[model samples]
Target: MPMLDAIKRHLWSIALFGIASNVLVLAPTIYLLQVYDRVLPSRSLETLSMLMMFMGIALSMMLAVDLVRHRLLSDLGRQLADRLDRLALAARIDTHARRLSRPELATAQDVAALRAFLSGSGVTAFLDMPWLVVYLGLMFLFHWSLGLIAIVSALLLVGLTLLNDRLTENSVRAYTTRQRETDQMAAQISRNAEIVTVLGMNAAMIDAWSARRCVDLDAQVKAGETSSLNRSIGKALRQVIQAVMMGAGAWLVINQFATGGVMLATTILLGKALAPVEQMLGSWKQFTEVRQAWTRLDALYRSSPERRAVELPRPTGRLTVEALAFSSYSATGPRGRMLLKGIQFVLNPGQLLVIVGASASGKSTLLRLLAGLWEPQAGTVRLDGADIAQWPREALGRFLGYVPQDVELFAGTVAANIARDPNPAAADTGAIVRAAQRAYVHETILGLPNGYETEIGESGETLSGGQRQAIALARALYGDPRLVLLDEPNANLDADGERLLNSALLQLKRDCVTVVVVTHRQSVLSIADRVMLMRNGQVDCFGTREQVEAWVKSRARPAAAPQSGEQRREAAAS
Candidate 1:
């Protein structure tokens, strides 16, 4: 009942309606039984027929009430699920800047499970439990001894329910681990379907994956059985106690120690009393599942306020990083090794800083910090002298355009991709086309069967890597961000694509945009205002192309290499 407060309004009405309907069904049956005992003692055929007809009518009413109640509960369940999903979505968006750790991702799984529980099990069974409560209470009123016995049996069943909860929690954790492995296998197969088939390892890979899955599934089945057994034990105990109580009650009446009508009523009430216990025991599994789900959803809903804290202020001007440092805890790296340390960088109007280094030199990490995707552990990234942390996420995003090495495009038309710019009016069609033209992708798109209106397949699969890169660049340019961080723009491009990239770089400089490119491509040398060389998470060298290389070769050999004017001429030639 953690988030029960949030959903109490919906729960109250659903539970009340369900309990009322269930009580009404029992009411008519109870009334008919009383009339039969009182009026049919003379044993008239017509009167007996009338009693039978009344019983039939009572049963019909019960069925109708059950149907209506079931439908309402189902609808309520769906609505609650929908509400929770919306809340989860909002929370995710609000925490978009949060780089989730493994534990955080595990918590996200709880949210997903909660959604499934609300839709499938939690709401319905929980709302219906009150009806069982009413049934049990009525039975208690008929005979105090029977009531005491049932109450004790229910307390024992509650213990079983708690045990079931423990078992279910373990199963859910194991299932989550299994699901991650399964998802990885599925993604691998999907990404390399053709390669697997060509290499003739498809069957072997599938066999391996299936073997792992089978092992996990077997463990899950065993845990399920254990849980079922626990519930069964509780149920069997309840049945045993029920039999003993009913037997004792009947024995006293048969021995002429009690009145027949009261005894008969007690017998009837005993069945009704057991009815609640039976239903409650039956619902214990679902109850445990939902309890865990509720716990998870509760945590998310509580953390939602923290996620919404990044939207208070707006940012202004180009981003600048000053003495930024970041460290990621890893098992393999040197102790206390910084991912980035004392990294001084500046991007003003019309300045292009090209960062060239080998992979794992913290290029992407630097871009992330500058883009406000993550807050720096030490030092500050500021826009116009104000810390980016003070800026609203949306406002900061508006001024910073970032395209990572792996470009992910949504499934949409070309126009949609370009207009994904938060403010499309600022990104006119002419502007989008010019950006694409500079990236050398405009004519190719115009020649497509449907031009800009054509649908791109999943993740823009219909487009080549170079084409996707060009489209992404177009999107970045559409935003007109003063600071543009491009991680390997020429990564998967042909000669023409590289030439287009060079042209785009020249235009960015001309437009007075602060552009930072992270690349290892030698061809990108011509567009660099200054090259910063990084090694071991520190800026080892910073200067013109020859100055940096001469320093590198000097470190390699004994004497310093000669700095010639010819190298400078060559730099200008490119």
Candidate 2:
């Protein structure tokens, strides 16, 4: 509805153009009638000349109407595409964040399909189908038999269209599903190409990918064959009907029921009447695709409805979470157990808190909730005593900085990534440099091929793990955010990178910015003002750094003195 809302204003104008077009369409039939009935008997050159001029003028006007109508539809398609671009992207993000079943599987390609459908001949043909009545009415004026023949022909074609749908509907659905699967597989291979080659999975993956592609191709072939066969039959059927009408017309002429010119004109009228039906049959496949795309787009827009946010002043990083609860969605529905429950905590400005937990102990989940990425089933996450959701989504980056466990960068210059610029050309160069310096990655960046202007490949695949994490740290610290949420910031960092990260955390405290870190490294605990040890989604201990350390020692957990990040993670999980 949102996308169609963009183009609703043009619909009436299109309808007016359609009326003009249909009226002008009578020129050819009337021309033939005049030449045969009036000019041939009178043998008048002047009359013929005037008729020819009139015919040309009528056709010219029709062409002009068609051109304007085409431009209107084209503009509508572009408007729909522009409106859907933002909605699809936001829906994608929300869908992934909510961890819900993606039955709709909406994507940008759906927008392209909708645009193409609106601009393509299929829509014009569809619009023309309704005007078949105009041709039917003209044929009836010529003779009752001619109108009867036209009605039967139209009925047959409509029946074929329905039959086409029934025979190929399943095949079309299969083709759509397989096509999405194939695309997803290709993306997976591209993303994991490094590991696939390193592990000698090229041959196996190629066979698997080929097999999936073949399934898609087979479904496509089945649907296409059915559609093409129906189209061929429909075409043949139209020819037969035209021949029958012609025979009837000649018989009527012989019986003095119609003039020779009238007989010829009935043939032309019948063909004109059937044109839209034939076209609709030919474009049945496209119609199906467009219908599916529209359905998916509609569902996506509904899932993520637009909301108005009430403006509030900048938060001072007073974070609070009381009696929070969250659960994962299983295939059937929400899981029976909560992932995070009874999560109660408060961190004021200038305070630094570190959270340590096992793989599934909900540390990362809690961080996501605190960052307002995920909503809790119960209780609320508040900043400055107001609900986090009160601030508009566009203003989130200014309120908090988040560094997830997986550090993947977009494809752009280093400075653009640091500044988080949606448009790289207008990035804040000075702020970018300061953030990079604060994260202690400026020196490393300078050593790159183009310094801050280097083009990092997709997901920063060109960089090493430690270098990627270092740049991610800079990105998280880019703007003057009031709070920072970090999940395993030092997981992939080297010794120098870890030292720089510690310095950055210390700097945040000096600036009175509340910071919460989830890590498996002992180095962070040394600088932590407070610590929380999570066990089975519950806070097992919460106190000063020494208190949590003593609790870990009493439990005989190896978390107090971690030798390696991986070992610490394994120990905490155990």
Candidate 3:
């Protein structure tokens, strides 16, 4: 349905071209009739020459019209792809944020499939299908018997097409699903090649991948077998139909109901009428694929939220979280595990808040909420007295910087990675240099073979873990964002990296930027003006450094050793 909506404007042009092309097709049959019935009996050179000229002119016009038609379809395909690409990408991002099943790859592949079908011969066959009726009507005028044969042949081919669709539908759907899963698995394995190799787990990974591939392969083979069978049957049926049309025409001529030229022309017309059907049958697989692609893409577009129509002002550095809660679900039921519960906190401009907690204590979840990467189930994260969700995503991104525990860098030059630039050539060189300098990795980058131009392998594999973390930190610091959230920012940093990180934080504090750091390291805690201790999805303690430290000590102190009887008596006397 969406596909039709996209190309409706161009449909009229395609239809006109089909009409002109089919009309010109009549020139050949007419020429054959004239040659057999009139020219031969009259022996008129003028008539033959004139007919030849007309035939040539008609065919040349047909060629030109058909060419234009194909070009229009190709343009339509381009238009569809351009319109859907951004929408599809945005939908994928939204789905990921919601922690839903990812269908990005499948969506992209579906768009490509539809585009290919639109620009291929399959579309041309579809456009010409309407001409079958015109051809059949002309055949009926030749003789009743010939017309009857043509009608029956068309009906049989149509029946075969419907049968093929019925037989292959389920298999095709299964094959497509399995193929997407296999592709995702292969990609995961490729990205983790180093780990698999070092752990000697290649065999195991391959076996796992092969299991999925085998299921995909089985579905493909079954679908292919059925499709091939239909193709074979369709081909045999066409040949038989052509033979019967010829034999029937001969019979009509023997009965003096039709002339030899009429017989020949009727047979040719019958073939022309069946051509579209045969072509469609041959390309049924592609047709089915396109249909499936359209359905999926339509659903994706429908599910995505519309973009913000109005812009909001930029946010200041004050950050607040009120009663934030989050949970996830599964098929059986809700996971019944709350990652964050009743989270309430506030940090003013130019202040630092450090959150300390053991693993699975909801520390990272709070940071993610503050960054607006995940939405709260029952509360709001506000910046400068306005809900973060109220601001446009792009506008919010300008003032928000976040670094997760796991750092990933794109495949590009060091400068591009540091700048977070989607287009490297257009990136701000000065901004990149400043960020790199602030992170204290500028000199290290210069020491490399190509200063800022060195290419980092995928996910920055070419660099050490510390180098990646430093660059990622520099990326977060880019533009001097108003609010910065870091999860274990010093996790991989060595002594020098840690020193640079501290310097950066102090500078941010001086610049009046709000910062939230989640760490277990005491060195990081020492700089915090305020600290919160998280345990079991709730804040256990929240106060200034001294107050929180005192509480932590009180909690950590073991109960005094059981007093001996003499010690207890001395204490009571005192």
Candidate 4:
């Protein structure tokens, strides 16, 4: 209902268009019925020809109007959807600090729902209301009692529609769940493709996932079928009721004829009275479905938590986290469980701080807090003298360049990806080339068929591991931020690739940019000015390379000796 109100507020022009279309369509239907007595009574070739010609003209006009309406509605729908997408994206961008679940994926569905809401429910409401009015008015003009019969049937059909709505509510929920599972299955199958091929278990693995997909799809199909069956049954019942009404009207006219009072044209009017009632019953289901879909889509837009904007606190250089703590509650666990506790750190300009930790040690979460991507549940994060909590997201971004472990690339040329936001001043080609060369991705890109102009394909699928990392670093460097937060920058790099990353970090430090790198690689110990080992959600130790290395090696496992020929062969087979 809120969506309907919003649409009605903006669609005054569309309403006028609808009104014109309704008048054009109804004029012919009404004129023909009113003049039926004169036209039908003649039963001559001349009259028949004239009637056929008029009908043909009316039909052509209706077809032309329908085509025009379709074209206009489609264009309007696309524009409306695009506008809503921009609004949604703006809302997301404004709340950039808040962590979002499946953020990018939600945009597709949200935009699609908006388009369907506009074209189907929006235009239909405007166009159909007038048709309903004219249709009922013609029924009343035919005969008083027959008009009442049509109205009663319409009311009953409306009741059936409401009942069907209640019955189909569960189906919508099931459809959404099934769709999510289907998406997950698709992602998993794609990720496990190489594993399945090497193990020669492709058929078995595929069958397992395919069976799950089929089960989910079957549930969706069953829900659809049930909803369809309910609608079909409701329509059939309405038709039967209309048929009985028509039969009674015919009987009444015959009885009047026996009493020498009935007219042929009057009896014909009874059929006309029932026609619109049948159509109203038929369109009722679509109207209800569309209305429900619109309401569901609108509820999200209205109640979205990201719409709020808070005052931003201004921050200078030297980012700091003082006794910062954050907690994440799992759906399967008790609430209020802490993920990070009393985490304190600082990285000033011209400094390099290395955070070393095992996988899932809440290391990345600490980086996010430092980057101001998230607020701590307790304690404070400060930049210079200002609280990070108050800093504007864009202002904070200007100072920090974060590269996550899993780098993402858009489907575009390497040059476009490197210079993500093209500036009027332009990224100096020499600088870009030097950065690429430092990341060790320069020669790899040049080897591609089109060099820097080559399309990376979806998510940089065409690029190798080292190439992807270098591209991501180049993107981050393009901004020339004062602080760089590298989350496992050497994750996908070989020994030579790691050397390139070290060279780039050294260059950044020389430029007076603060660098914070998270890694578990012992090889990176030589490059750090101060190495901090993070464990159990807090800083375990911070000191010189030898001091941290001694502690790390004390707790670390020794390297395994080389295996014999048979052992090596067995390892290979395994």
Candidate 5:
């Protein structure tokens, strides 16, 4: 609706063009009348030649106006697409961050569909629909009975169109929902193709995928069948109307209320009046699809959160977390169990803090909160004395680097992956190589056939898991980020990879970059200035490395000591 106001000028121009084109549509009927009533009776070649010249000029003007109308619509559609594409993508990304299910935000495909409808024949039909009255009035000029019949036929076709819409709306909606779910499932299967193939899950996966496909297909078939039936009936009725109009015209002419030329011209005018309605009936499905797409896009745009208008300066490495808490939605709905509660920590610039915890101990949740991937329900995360939400996202991203537990690379060249730049040409080659060197992946990259220019398959499928993690580490270290968060960075690393990771962390520390790493391996703890141990979503210990290690040893001593005299006697016998 607001979008309509934006393109009002374009719509007005199209309306003017429609009026001119429909007026010229009367040229053929006029030509027939002149030929039958004037030229033949008088045997005047001059009159025929003059009429032909005027008709030619009128039709040419009509053609020129129609072309301009189409061009305007196309330009309008392009402008709309350009404006909506970025907003749609942003909304989709925001929805993902909020952990919301909004399949309509998955892509800008809906924008494209709306654009196509705007520029295609569907719009032209809509613009011409209003001119149907003009043709009907022309029919009335010839006789009253013909006008009555034309009005009745038009109403019948309009009723049929309304019926079609009512019958197919629900099925179309269901089909759209099912199709999006199936597409998502298919993408998931493709991403995990290696696991499926190695585990011999091809049959089970295929069966599951096919089940969704079948449901989607069933909905589509139901909608299609209803639309097709209506279209066929509309076509048959349109033919009948044309024939009946001609017969009625002949009756009027025979009764001396009209001329033969009047009868013929009126019948042709009737068809012209109903042509747009017939075309709309046949294109009801496309019209419905475009309407749904527009509705979804509008809803998405309206629901998207307003972004910060003011940009702030980049942050320094000093980090703070105060009573942070967060929860996620469960399968049932909102208000699920909490994942992190009262999480408190602080790390100054140039500090190296290592977090050690068992599996499912809230380590990853803490890292995500620190990295701003998930917002805390309570408390504030601050950097450089400013709340994380206060700083502009782009500025914050430049100062922060995060390597998640599951390392995956996008489809691009090795250099591009390391740079994390969408535009490869704009990527800084020097910085990329420096980051790779720091991550100790430079030599391994050079050993490849094309080195930095080598193409990495989707998610780096062509390379080993260690190779992917190394490049991802390089990405995190790119541009000498002021703050780095690594979650289990050495999960897939070999001995050499582990050494490179530690060396990278050491170099980062020397550069005054604050770092937080989550690891179970004690080897990585050698570089830690402080240690935080977590248990059951709470911090068990937080202090200097020496203090935490001594506590750990003391706790182990009790469990290692003899628990009973029987155990002591067995040991003495041995």
Candidate 6:
């Protein structure tokens, strides 16, 4: 919409340029007429020189005007990219975090495609197309028969173009859809290349990708073949129509119904009239892509409308979750099987709560909800007595820290990864160093080739798992956050790394930073102020660490042999 609005602002000026350019283009036709009809008959060199001089000036002006139009369109495209790039990226991240968008919907690519369309000649073709009538009118002015021929030519070309579109539309859509799927599959395979390689399925993966690629390619070729054939037809038809117009003009001249000048002028006028149509037909594929891109982006933006938020005063580390419930998608509806249910809890400033659970017991889900990365299907998660949703995400993020089960870094310097992930150039070096020290990873970072400036590849693939985890901890600890959420923080840690992590947690506790962690480590459990055990989407047991440990031990022990009825009755009476 913004792009359209920008174009609308410049629409009149662009139209004016098109008008001037088309009128100036008429100079050549006018010159031929003047030379053949006036200069030759009068045998005057003065009139011919004057006409050529005016033609030269008009041609120069036309070039300048067209250049300005092109520049305006190019700048408009750049502005579109500048304005929508961040919004598309933010919407994408928000959608992924909230599980609101289909994975195949790539907003960034759509924006890029739209930009390409605006900057290229696709839009200009449509802009120049409206001037076709002026040229046709001039043809009519020459003679009625010439006008009839030009009209017929235009209609035939327009009809052919529409027919081409009708025949290829379905195949083009199929090709686009199949291409997206193929690209998604390729990205997935690349993301898991290590697993595929280790399993010796490289050939199989290649085969799978090639098969999908071929499907898309086949669809593309199917559409392209029709388009190519139709283009050839259109070109041949134009050529035939041009020859017919010339023959008719000569016949009219022989009969003394039209002059030599009129005959030559009509041909030039017909070309000007049909030029826009030909341009549009030649670039029809790009026009379709542009339309598709705009449609997708429009839909994406409409679905993810921006919201206004009021900044609230910051609060100390206190959290409350009430009647929380979450579910995974199913064949029936959005909320089907509950992953977590009735998960209520509270934490005061400086408190530490550890959650322990078996696989798929909703420990990770609970952590995600607490971190505000997900919305619960029922009830709410409140931080410092206010619903987390009430706070602007960036504002809320400042006071909270999170490290997921699978830690990830970025493709940037170590300093950038540790000191707030975005626009890291503004991140303070001293603060980065301090956070690293707090996480006990300062020495580790220093050992790198560039120390804090070391370039770590995507997801920190250049580093070992333990090193990645250690740096992620440093990132979470960077902002002096009031609440820290970590899941399996020590999963990949060496003994020293584990010791350093424990030390970091203790330091955070000492600093009155409320903490919630999900882990299976006994060492981590030993230091918790309280513990909660989750089982099958419900709280199995929750209490102080010692109490929970006792309950767990009791549950693990075998039950006493069933008592006889009389012994049970006697014990009850006692």
TM-scores vs. true structure, each candidate: 0.79, 0.94, 0.93, 0.75, 0.91, 0.93
lDDT of 2 at 92: 69
Full candidate order by TM-score, most accurate first: 2, 6, 3, 5, 1, 4
**CA error at residue 440 for candidate 6, angstroms:** 1.6
What is the C-alpha lDDT profile of model 4 across 435-473, one tens digit per residue? Answer: 566556788779989987788887788989778888988
Collision pairs in model 2: none
Q: Name the regions of candidate 6 deviating beyond 4 angstroms.
A: 1-3, 99-104, 301-308, 329-333, 422-425, 553-560, 563-574
lDDT of 3 by residue, 157-238 (tens): 9999889989988889878877887887898899889989999999999999999898889988888889889989999999
lDDT of 1 by residue, 1-574 (tens): 3466776777677666666556655655465455546655766777767766877876777678666656665665666566666666666554543444222322344555555555553455555544545555755675666566656665666666667667776776576567667766777788777689999988898998898888778867776787678768867876676677667667756875544454555555545545544554555555554555565567665554422444533333355678899886432333356789998866667777888777888888887787777666788988777787776665666677778877978887887787674344555677667666755688888987798777777778898888888888877776567778899988989998898888888888887787888998888887687788988788988877778878889898977577699997997999
Query: Which RMSD does model 5 reach against the true structure?
Result: 4.5
Clash tally for model 3:
0
Instruction: Please identify model 3 stretches exceeding 4 Å from their true place.
Output: 1-3, 93-98, 103-105, 303-306, 329-336, 557-574
Best of the two (2, 6) by lDDT: 2
Location of the lowest summed lDDT over 10 successive residues in candidate 3: 327-336
* Collision pairs in model 5: none
Candidate that beats the other on lDDT, 1 or 2, i.e. the better one:
2
Candidate 6 lDDT over 330-357, as tens digits, reads 3234665889999998999888999998
Query: lDDT-based ranking, best first?
Result: 2, 5, 6, 3, 1, 4
lDDT of each: 0.69, 0.86, 0.84, 0.66, 0.85, 0.84
Clash totals in order? 2, 0, 0, 2, 0, 0
**Top candidate (lDDT):** 2
Local lDDT at 548 for model 6 = 92
- For candidate 5, give the lDDT: 0.85
Displacement of residue 468 (Cα, Å) in model 2 is 1.1
Candidate 6 collision pairs: none
| Model 6 CA RMSD to the hidden true structure, in angstroms | 2.6
Q: Between candidates 1 and 6, name the one with more favorable lDDT.
A: 6
Give, for candidate 1, the lowest lDDT window spanning 10 residues: 99-108
